[model samples]
Target: MINVKVMAVLDLVSILQKREIAFSVEDGTTIRGLLEIMCSQYGPELEKKIYVDKDKELLNLNLYLNGRHIHFLGGLDAVLRNEDTVLLIPYASGG
Candidate 1:
């Protein structure tokens, strides 16, 4: 099992109905696979909040695996291990 912690992103919290969740995934599951599962479990609205396009080519949120950014680890292809913690952080912009 892996744990996912969703930061205080209102839209996402509303969709997921919780700030943190734990679920089982097949061993060797990648981050992309995990996101896909979340989309299916929560709904397309969750996908829209995370993905930048219908093609799912870009991520609008920042993903961290056990405190390290996914980009540095291996982007969406980063493989998850049992008991790993993935944190989802929303992007913020103001000027």
Candidate 2:
């Protein structure tokens, strides 16, 4: 199994309870799969914040893997490794 650290920002703290969590996923699990597991644990409220559709497409939230944006790596398909860190930063809009 691979150990990953997940950091949630902004409103996500309400769902996650804590600012960060350590997750253990099966080896070779992609970012998307890890997120699915998290959603299941956190329930529907978190599911709606992260996924845009039933297909589990990521919403507009900015996701970073080890301080690097996931979009640069490969979006949700980005493979994770032991001790990798994932940070979720939600978009803020308003004056």
Candidate 3:
């Protein structure tokens, strides 16, 4: 089993109902797989906030793995390791 912690900021705090969560995933699970697990646990309210096009793609949420953006690590395919910390921060735009 792979153990990880998730830190959520902004509106996600309310959506998830907590600022931090302890999560577990199977070994070799990827970031996308983690989100899928969360979706199953949290249901559509959480799913709608993160996925678009019926879960085909990620929405505006920004995912960081151990302080580095997942976009640079390997997108959603980035393999998770034990004790990894995944930070979720929604994209914000202001003019």
Candidate 4:
């Protein structure tokens, strides 16, 4: 199974904490698959919190594959391998 680290933006931590969304996905699923699942559970509105537009155009959110940014690689369509580390980090920050 793959491993995912879901990090919320500082401003969006409340939503994630409220929903009890943790920092891991232990199943071998594609990036798109995981995002879809998150949308269904957290609603499409939540997708915009992490993703860019409603059309899923990626914003400044950083998706790293074992420490490599997806944007510098395959973007969101990137494939996942067993034991791969998927880290999703929102660019927003707050004190």
Q: Against the true structure, whose TM-score is highest?
A: 2
User: Model 4 over residues 8-38: C-alpha lDDT tens digits?
Assistant: 5455566555422443454656677767777
Off by over 4 Å in 2: 93-95
Q: After superposition, how far is residue 15 of candidate 4 from its true place, in Å?
A: 2.4
> Which number leads on lDDT?
2
Clashes of each: 0, 0, 0, 0
Q: Candidate 4, clashing residue pairs?
A: none
Better of 1 and 2 by TM-score: 2
Q: RMSD in angstroms, all models?
A: 2.2, 1.5, 1.5, 3.8
Model 1 ranges off by over 4 Å: 1-10, 93-95
Over 31-95, each residue of candidate 3 has an lDDT whose tens digit, in order, gives: 99999899899888888878765954756688999999999999999999999999988887788
A best-first ranking of the candidates according to their TM-score comes to 2, 3, 1, 4
Q: Residue 68 in model 3: shift from native, Å? A: 0.6
Clashes of 3: 0
lDDT of candidate 1 at residue 47, scale 0 to 100 = 89
lDDT order, best first, reads: 2, 3, 1, 4
Across 1-95, the per-residue lDDT of candidate 1 in tens digits comes to 55444343555677888877886888888889989998999888888889999989799898898889999999999998887788887787777
